[model samples]
Target: MSNRSYSSQPKSVVIVGAGIIGATLGYHISRRAGMTVTLLERDLPGAGASGHSFAWVNGFGKDPRAYHTLNRRSLDMWYRLAHQLDADIGIHYGGEMRWENDPRRATQLRQRVRQIQTWGYPCRLITRAEMLALEPHLHPGDVLAASLSEADIHVETDTFIDVCLRRACEAGAVVYSQTAVTGFVVRDGSIAAVKTVDAEFPCDVVVLASGVQTTELASLAQVQIPQQQSPGIVMKTTPCVEVLHNVAVIHAPAIDEKHQHLHLRQLSDGSLRIGQGTQEGINRDDSQQQADALLDRARAYLPTIGDARAIPTPVGYRPMPLDGFPVLGFTEAVPNLYVALMHSGVTLAPLVGEMATLEIVDDVRVDWFASYRPERFSVRSSG
Candidate 1:
């Protein structure tokens, strides 16, 4: 709306993707004074990994550092937005039960509790009996000990942004769907316009958040960003008549199926979500068969999950930066261009959006994001 087209708002913004992170960033930053937001999406909102996701607002699983800090901040912001937007992200923050195998693992979980508490997040240690009481279907043999952090939420990314994006549009942002940004028009070192198959949208600033496709857009801006894809899949069951109320994750190493880490969670609609396994490669193919094997194996970890009404397999590619940690903020080489890419997106989306919004619109330092600059690898190479 203002003539200052050099930021997320105030300046016209052409966001390349409309996933959760991009939409949230657009939604939050568009509400600022003196700004216009123009969101460009290759597909419908939440269609990408944002839509096909585990949607766990997991503050407990992140490593204990800036990753944890960023995730925790995002969790706080999500709860705030749950109230502010009054939209459904299927936010259930009751708590997650992390199952343990033995005293040693239980001790390790105690350490996790100690670590989070040391950072000022409270968590409760529960016994096997307590866990069974919470998630009755959990195999008593599979779970030895557990940790329950009542701070986080379980979410469904599919419909999470319907309201936020709608609110963003209502508040003056223009979202172009099914219209991909073929490329960008760069003048000098700043972005001049965003080109698509339809029309050229001239803008002062551009945010590249096209998920796994970010590398392509980065190339358009003349930045050789190295982003890799990691595949992890989750299976969902049709709504259960008595789906357990809380999230349940087993910690024991021993399992009935081939050895791997496994997790179990009950969706608000009474469906069960199960995830386990990490596959790293450039796989464009959906590993439905491979995931089915894992899900079959996962049923043994939690027997009740196999009593499915219907099993829907979902595949996800975690965008692991060659340098672990997300890539965010403006490039040291290009002006008016910002990026947001992450492997653990839902955990980092809210913070990345809020912080990146803080960086792009307000010209703030974004010191918290020092760990995630894409240029750092290039700088390190030259150094």
Candidate 2:
């Protein structure tokens, strides 16, 4: 923790991207004294990946104890943030239910469960009987093992983003929709203003939270933030009778195969959000076919989506780092420019927002984010 204090003068901040990460940061920063914040979005808030996210808030399957701890901390923060936002962001702490069919994969999952348990995470392998008790709707077809984690939570991603943006505006942060960042004004090796297609917004600091487009935006400042983006499809079905009681179910894919898994969760409005865990890039021609396949899989798992129409929703690129972790913190070469980009943006939003505000407003560097600094990718040249 650094003891440096920020200047007493108000800092003008220009946040590029009005997604959940940027919106949350803007909300926190605007609440502080001596700060003027502006959030710029090419479209409306949550119009990017935030709108299309499966939005399962969980720390499970995250590697490196430090990263998992950070996600868990954010999970804890969500409880307070939901109430503080004073809106029904559709936060359901209904936990997550996951299972594997293959014998080898079952062993791997059990080992992971043990590892997470040692880390004090609330996860445990359950017997088939227990699994059925937890989710009677699931068709337990040759499930080798199953695990239940009460710590997991899911949310309505779009609504949550809306709440974050609304709160940010209420806290005095100005938001500009349909304004795209075209370039950056660099003065003495620091960003002086963010140039948009419509106008230039001068600011003392600029934060890049533009999801998959972060790498592109960072280049305007000659900074590198590498990303491995993959197009993902999320299908939402018309409202139906409740099929799942409380838990979101994830069917793990077999070993050696990347694309053939399904994750389904029920929204508060009785709609099912189904995600095809396959990385089959975007196929405009085959989108309806893909959506049909996802709905078929959901029906196979839980016979509840009977005769329901599936709408191919969101379909955005996941903003993942090249190394499969988050790229956060400020760039060393461009000290005034900060970035917050990650795949699990939904799970990490609140905590990242709070910590980022501390770093930007109070000048207190969070030691935990040392590994996730944007400088990590700056060392490598963009291909």
List model 2 lDDT by residue over 1-383, tens digit each. 43222243438999999888998898889988878899999998888988887888887877789989999999889988887888888787768888888888789889999999999899989888887787787775777889998878888877887878888888888999999999998887888889987688988778998998999999888888887757777788888888777676465453336446678888878888877553334423227777887787778777877887788665578888888788887777877888899988889998999998888877657887888888777565587
Give the Å shift of residue 325 in candidate 1.
0.3
Which residue runs does candidate 1 get wrong by more than 4 Å? 1-9, 102-104, 248-257, 278-306, 309-314, 379-383
All candidates: TM-score: 0.87, 0.91
Q: What is the C-alpha local distance difference test score of each model?
A: 0.71, 0.81
Sliding window of 10 residues with minimal summed lDDT for model 1: 277-286
Q: 119-175, model 1: which lDDT tens digit per residue?
A: 867577888778767777656565555777777666767666777788888889999
Residue-level lDDT for 266 in candidate 1 = 69
> Which ten residues in a row are the worst by lDDT in model 2?
1-10
